[model samples]
Target: MPATLLIPLYRDEVAPRFDLAGEALLVHLDADGAELSRSSVLLAHASSEELCRIALEEKVRVVICNGIDDEFWQYLRWKRIEVIDNVMGPVDEAIARFRADALRPGDILFHRSDA
Candidate 1:
């Protein structure tokens, strides 16, 4: 069966904090990891509880975000939802890394230029 993934968004990048995220990107992937569909979810407000509820309601198999509180992290883990936290980058880059199985906790995918 295909799997579903969620990534909280802040503009075009991953949200810096999961609890404060007001939008999310939902992606569906097939067994071989090819993207099946993608969509954006706009939340009425920023709330960890609401995000978690959405994850559950959508049957999300994985969540990728920048920072997440231990409470919510543990809750998702307890519910068997895989979380790849501490990821910082453009949503497209993060999704590509995830699809390639290269995304990991604490990954910083942003490019830095020396001034």
Candidate 2:
């Protein structure tokens, strides 16, 4: 079986706040964790309600994002959507981690600068 995942995007990285995300990436993966399809969805506006509606409409199984409100989180959970919140990094790295079943809440995938 295949499953769908959603990631709120800010340029090439994961959006810092779910309620403020203006775009999202939808990915479909096979039972073996191989990607079946990926597409970007541009929101009409940045709104948690809108995002929630989109998630339901798209039948998203998972969501990767940061700074989600507890109300929204609980709602998604109640609706059976798996949310991995507080992630910070490039979208590609996050997706790779997810595909490998290593992505978790509060993960920071960005490299630190020594400077």
Candidate 3:
């Protein structure tokens, strides 16, 4: 079966911090790089515990988020969920890079104001 990815969202972009996000996006992608579906979930609040619960409940295989707490990061990894952390970009671009096997930890696909 194809894998599912969970991404915390902030205004159509990857949330800057996982624990601070109040919204989430779940993406289902097939092995052939086709997007099966995409949906947004409004979180009850910004809580890592709640987020982890959803991930587990949804059987998410991968998580793409920006900043994440060390403890929570370790916890997800321990649960066998692959986390691609520190990804700063629009949701579509991020997923594209992931599908191409080009996305990496700390990937910044959005325009950098510092440039």
TM-scores of the models, in the order given: 0.96, 0.96, 0.94
Off by over 4 Å in 1: none
Tens digit of lDDT per residue, candidate 3, span 1-114?
588999999998999999999999999989886899999999878888888999999999999999999999999999999999999999889989988889899998988788
Error of 2 at 11 (Å): 0.3
Q: What is the lDDT of residue 41 in candidate 2?
A: 94
Question: In candidate 1, what are the lDDT values of residues 1-115, reduced to their tens digit?
Answer: 5789999999999999999999999999999999999999999999899899999999999999999999999999999999999999999999999999999999989997962
RMSD to the hidden true structure, all candidates: 1.2, 1.1, 1.3
Note the residue pairs that clash in candidate 3.
none
Give the clashing residue pairs of candidate 2, or none.
none
Steric collisions counted per model: 0, 0, 0
Shift in Å, residue 80, candidate 3: 0.3
Q: Give candidate 2's TM-score.
A: 0.96
Candidate 2 lDDT over 1-115, as tens digits, reads: 6789999999999999999999999999999999999999999889899889989999999999988999999999999999999999999999999999999999999989972
